[model samples]
Target chain A: MLQFAAIILLMLGLYGLLTQRNVIKIIISLNILEIGLNLFIISVGYFEGGLAPIFTSETPANPNFVDPLPQALVLTAIVIGVGTTALGLALARKIYQKYGTLNLDEMGEN
Target chain B: MLDNIEVLQVLEIVIAVFMVVLAFLAINSKSLIKAVMFLSALSMLSVIGFVVMQAPDVAVTEAVIGSGLVTSLFVFTLLATKKVGVK
Candidate 1:
């Protein structure tokens, strides 16, 4: 069920990315794409009734735990998404300032 | 009850469906601010969905950076452009 949702989210993001002409909307679409990818990574780490990877002396030495790798990877990806978003928005601001319009078609004309 | 896994699964699916609708609305909205608002709604739903998926850390990050920080950044940039000033 989770995987199905993730796929739909990915397709929605791709649709927005392909169809949107405004630079800010493009950046927003990129964010949606990042979210879908992140969700998939976290879902890959899930284990039924599994504990987090943290270990305490009171806990059993060998216990079921959700995979920590994908969580770490998604953490990194989320930060990178933020940086990319900031950069994209800055560029959009510059484009708007220069072109005085947010439409891609108009910006393309000289 | 919220403790039931089945209930949680149902809730997660509902949120995901809402997010998909919001994504389409966001990308297709004629007004840029309306699009931004839809994006904000999408971010909020994603945060909730992340929590439902057993990713509390990711949920926190998404809530702070995705919904709050990114929305502010969008608004700031929109203001910076004279053509999109506070509209």
Candidate 2:
């Protein structure tokens, strides 16, 4: 069920990307899609009853902790998402400055 | 319990629906600023959904990058551009 919801979010983001003409909207949609993928990745590590992956002197040896790999992967993904958003917005600003408008169609006329 | 799972399923469905609606609005809204706001809202919802699904790290990242930095970037771009909607 969680996977299904993630897929739906992915599709919705894709639909927006394909249909939107505005550069900013396109970037937003892309972020939406990225979030969907992130959600899917994190959901993969969920266990019914898992402890946080921490170690202490009193910690038990029982291995019931959720996978930490996804957490690491998501940290990387978040950094990448920030970089991409910065680049996309910078490009949008340049597009706007050069064209004086945000509409792609209008900018294309130049 | 079965009831808990059922409730979770219902919550998931609601989140899915909200995501779809926000995605559509983000793309189709006439005002660029409004679209950006919608996108931010979508990101926030996704973050909440991630938390509910037991992904605290991802939820934190989404709230920070998706809702914080990205929204600011969009607003900056909006300010840079002349106010005009796609015809």
Candidate 3:
């Protein structure tokens, strides 16, 4: 069920991207799409009775803890994403200053 | 595997349809910005699918970087440009 919902969200983002002419709206749609994917990933890790993957001297024998590897990877991805977004934005700003428009049709690639 | 085959089959069908739709949207969009957004959405869906297949690390990365950071970058770029061309 959750998977289905995630998929729907993805579709919606895509639709928005394709349909929207404004650059900002397209970016927003892209973000929406990413959120859907993230939700799906987290949902996959959900086990009916899984516990948090924590370690302690007194509680080291539990075998039903959730996986921690994904969490770590996700954190790294988040940082990278931030960097990429910043760079892209910077580039966009530069383009705007140089060209003074967002309409791709008008900005001939000369 | 056979016991829950029916449920898995349903899931597979749903996922397949979703992917097809998203792929089309990403590539077929008229505007460059819209296309980028669709691409992000596609990335996110792939992350979720990975998680469902027992790959949590991939899911996390997709969620954070793909959705969060990438989108921001696209937005910034959009802001930089008022239109596709300089009028």
For all predictions, the C-alpha RMSD in Å is 2.6, 2.9, 7.9
Ranking of all predicted structures according to DockQ, beginning with the best and ending with the worst: 1, 2, 3
lDDT of 1 by residue, B17-70 (tens): 888888888878877777888888988988887777667777888899889998
Candidate 2 — which pairs collide? none
Residue-by-residue lDDT tens digits, candidate 3, B1-64 = 5546566556656664676566566545566666666667666666655555455556666677
Q: How badly does each model clash, as a count of residue pairs?
A: 0, 0, 16
Measured on C-alpha atoms, candidate 2 has an lDDT of 0.77
Worst 10 residues of 1 chain A by lDDT: A47-56
Clashing pairs in 1: none
lDDT (C-alpha, whole model) for all candidates: 0.81, 0.77, 0.59
Name the regions of candidate 2 deviating beyond 4 angstroms: A47-63, B1-7, B84-87
lDDT of 2 by residue, A3-109 (tens): 66777778878988888887887887888788778777877886655544556686687867778788789879878987998898898888878887666787767
Q: lDDT by residue for model 1 over A1-110, one digit each (tens)?
A: 66666777788889989998878889888887887888888888885566666676877878777888888898899899999999999999788878888879888584
What fraction of the native interface does candidate 3 get right in terms of contacts?
A: 0.23
Per residue, candidate 2 scores C-alpha lDDT tens digits across B1-87 of 678767866887788788878877877888877888888998898887776666676678778877998888777767667553433
